[model samples]
Target chain A: MVVAVAEESRGADHARPWIDQAKSDYWQLIDTEHRLEDLYNLVNVPQAIWIDEKGTIVRPPETAGSTDHFRRMDLKTRTLLPKDQEERLAARQAYVDAVRAWVTSGKHALSANAVRANLPRITPEMAESRARFRLGVWLRANGRAAEGDRQMAEASRLYPDSWSMWRQAADLDEVGKASSPAFWKRVQALGDKPYYPPPKF
Target chain B: MTKILTPTAEHDVAARDGLWMSPADAERVTGWTLKPEGMCRAEACVPLPASAVGTNEVDLAAFWARLGGPVIASDERDVWALGAPADERNATLEGLAAPDFTLPDVNGVPRSLSQLRGKKVFLATWASW
Candidate 1:
């Protein structure tokens, strides 16, 4: 079974059209509070976690076949050049093949110890940042925009790695700010660091 | 009244300076009720430290901090958020058990991760942005 979740603050208001377009028979959830982020330590989107029949996590959250090749795209054209697009597709296909192997033969599933070691570590700052993010979201929805923005900024400072938090806060301020030049600047700032670390089996 | 935020609910409760709230308010904000022994929810009980329990109120921030959860507040102290305990939040890392969550689908029907326990699940998350 496949369960897809749209982690949007506006919930169905923002995701309904995409959900409708998918036409998926599987469960499609709308998360307004980012429950998965708080629970699974997810930092970005297009991530997947594999669970087995006993509810054990066979795989911790990882990039679900997505790559950072978009960083090389032409922003003005908003398109990835053919070569980069092909490489991205190949990576996605490889991830899908691995998933198929796991489902069919449980060949790639990680042992419990391996899963434990691979789980993302929740640092003190990260935990506090998540709390501030939640508080900021609530404050913004409850008529405290300036205060909310402050809390969100503090959250971003505390956990610089959480592009999800920063982007969502940007989206709240301006509808297109998330994909704006600022996003590119942040990606460029990564320098040698990875935006989407490769998934480990 | 200060607005208290929890994972599943929010409440406006009376507080006297900082985050010290009446036991009743604490119980309302968090499902755990204050009793003679300690704070309790369902069958679990956690003994509160002396610093966390005041004359007739509880220092909610101290209580949650004792449980290794982050406690955040607004500048004016009008709003506060009590996060999940670090132990509970990171339990999946140690036990390999996927944490269960219930969320509303696009059609507004509530669905739970546990409902798919009998099968292999490819739990994928994406965003509209």
Candidate 2:
């Protein structure tokens, strides 16, 4: 089964014929808008759900195509230096390699025990943090900029070491829609942390 | 003993808190009815606040708030979130079955999900946003 994640803003006008071609080629095409709800089931982009012929999901959500961009040696070798950049780069590389291994092996490739061994168990607090981050996204989409920032801040607080959370906060701050110097400063502070630098700017 | 109240899909209450939905809206959007006294729509049962459930009305605020939804208010023309509230649900999307909708396509042609059932339906949605 081939699942195509399309941007919600552009429906199937651009994707219909290609999907049709895939169908003619004997592929079962399931197209969906890359929605936050999908993220709830699967995190990261280019994710795929391998459903068996009976329609049962054989594989739970996992990141599909592409390697992590931050892991390249070129990025690590770049000139303008932050002191903790190397460590961050190494961690990113590890994450990328892990994802690559998972993709190549599918479920059998990586034993369930091994997968569980590497994964950080989702605690209630962590789950709540993820929910808050989603709420932030929903609020931003609904035009509640300030509320979104507040929710993002809560998420950052709950998961202070998460680069994704910090990066999201920084992105919202940089957008300047919720213009507050203090908020931007908080974003910068999150970047200054050794393990989790704020995403570039 | 506190009786656990369940909100079914049949209760047609306006979701004042922007979380619990009216039966009509839920059915229209999700192709499921809120019933079973616990937000039961089809096979799903979402437990709700007992005090809020009534024969004709649902306490939209209490119900949706429990589901991590904050009630939104609208001015004459625009609606906005009331405040920042933490979400309790998973950020991941639920793999619920998509309800069949029979709406007009862009050219004013009506289409239904039943018409496309046997074939692999590549459904996509668009908004002007």
Candidate 3:
């Protein structure tokens, strides 16, 4: 089953259109609050975690997009796009190729130790940021917009590298639009950072 | 009806008819569950006093405060915001298991990651933006 962990604020209303249009058979769960970021240690979208049947996470969260994702446009337009586009794409393909290898190799895939070592590095600061983000989401969800903004801003400040958290927090200020110009500016600033930590194969 | 809010889900828990869903709702709102020991998310567990659980309800404020995660309550006592426990979250990072959580589908029916244990889940989090 393909599980889709959407942002905390968007429920089925944001996702149902795409699924309905495709007539998808798989499960597309909606996250009303955006809790998946903390649990999965996700900082951005199109990231994935590979878990074996034993309920153990084989591959930690990392940027994994189809090569086609980058083929269409130049990174110059998509300011949020990672700077190391080709290098990241190669890493994504390597990870995909590794997945194919794992599907065939099963328990014998590459080196288990290497996979185990691939878990995303979560520092104490990250944990605190996640907790702050959760509180921010909850505060905003409960009609306390100002408090929510304060907390979300703190979370974003704690981890400026995570565009997801930053973007989510920025969305709180918009009236009707999806994002404000400030969000794009933030993305432009993040254009040079290790936006998506290069995938590990 | 108590409204439990989380980053991914929200639940209006009615008075229990047979099974008490407060803990389930709590876990849905936060990644922690009320086990026999206490509120548990993964390898870590926070022990709650006997008073925290009533016959068919859980005190969200009490539970939240006890968990040692930042929690703020509204004046009306209807809404509560829960923060993730720092130590438990750190343990989750250390253990490397995605914390289990149940969320509703587009139709508002509940689904959990644990139920799909044997299947390969390509969980992707996206938004309109």
Candidate 4:
């Protein structure tokens, strides 16, 4: 029997097609359950945990399978360029391969700390940037548009090229009454990187 | 050192629920922030719009509803409050032993986690919206 955990955020609607494809291809797809606000708890996508017959977590949290809808050209060698894109792509590919290995070999085949040890180190700046991002989201959600914008601006300064940051800033601007076309344009100007589409309202 | 509140704390407070949280609460306890990403104590991060930085409160309703999260509400001081369980379908706490829960499937038949015991359960989540 197989149980699957689907961590859904606002934009998860866009992932449905790809998830369906994964179910058809790799997994038996027995049960699909949704976890709300799970991303904030689970941190990474495609996280998988294996439970033994006694309901003990046999395998700790690990990055599981992923859906890659984009082609090589879509991610690599894309139009608006960033030098880090290549590195990011390579890391993703490697991570995917590692997950595939885990699925095929099971827990015994791989060391438990293998995945955890390989995770990228979190820098103080990155942590601060993430905090500011959350603050911005919280502010906008609570109807504090200007405060949210300020937090978003700080995020951009810290992680200038992050698609996640830009997308968020755009969301705040679009939702609040203070939203402006110019703000949307600024978000668009951040240039196309491989960004997960926002969930439809 | 200044007290730091987990993302979840800010969220709970912003939601107007009196889910009390102390500033010294560890990230793991709150399950609100992760090492690299913004997750709660359970190490889950919902990809919401925002940089995951400074005082940004995510729209919990939007994020949870999209993810099919089970909305659990409580009333404190005459205000209706809402919170997303660690497990949406099962409504279990994170990092703890899985709780015994039974729910009807699309066919309206009841199923429980205990029934699936002994087999390695690979729970995968999905949604329509």
Best by DockQ: 1
**Which segments of candidate 2 are over 4 A away from where they belong?**
A1-77, A80-108, A116-120, A141-143, A175-201, B1-14, B17-21, B26-32, B41-49, B60-129
Per-residue error (Å), model 3, residue A47: 1.1
User: Tens digits of per-residue lDDT for model 2 on A26-113?
Assistant: 2222222223222232333344333332232334444343333332224244432454455656655664464344445542332334
Give chain B TM-scores in order. Answer: 0.80, 0.39, 0.50, 0.30
Task: Give me the candidate number with maximum lDDT.
Answer: 1
Off by over 4 Å in 4: A1-109, A160-163, A175-201, B1-5, B11-129
Candidate 2 lDDT by residue in tens digits, B3-86: 111111112224443434455644443343456556655676668766766664455445455555443332221232322123
| TM-score result, candidate 3 | 0.68
Name the 10 consecutive residues with the lowest summed lDDT in model 4 chain B.
B72-81
Candidate 1 per-residue lDDT, tens place, B15-129, comes to: 9787898898888777789887888888888899887898889987877887788899888888888887767777756788888899999889999999987899999988988
Query: A64-90, model 4: which lDDT tens digit per residue?
Result: 443223222232434323544565466
- Model 2 in CAPRI terms: which quality? incorrect
Give the interface RMSD of each candidate.
1.2, 9.3, 3.2, 10.1
Model 3 steric clash pairs: A5-B125, A8-A32, A8-A33, A8-A34, A32-B8, A33-B7, A33-B8, A34-B7, A34-B8
How does model 1 fare in lDDT? 0.87
Candidate 2 chain B worst ten-residue window by lDDT: B1-10
The 10-residue segment with the lowest total lDDT in model 1 chain A: A7-16
Candidate 3, A1-201: lDDT as tens digits: 567766746346767777677677777777755667777667777677776665666767777653333332454676325655666567667766766666556632324456557655665567567766766677676678897788778877887667778777766667433345575455456554554566644
Query: What range of 10 consecutive residues in model 3 chain A has the weakest lDDT sum?
Result: A66-75
- Comparison by DockQ, 1 against 3, better one: 1
Q: Give the TM-score of candidate 4.
A: 0.36
TM-score of chain A of each: 0.96, 0.44, 0.74, 0.42
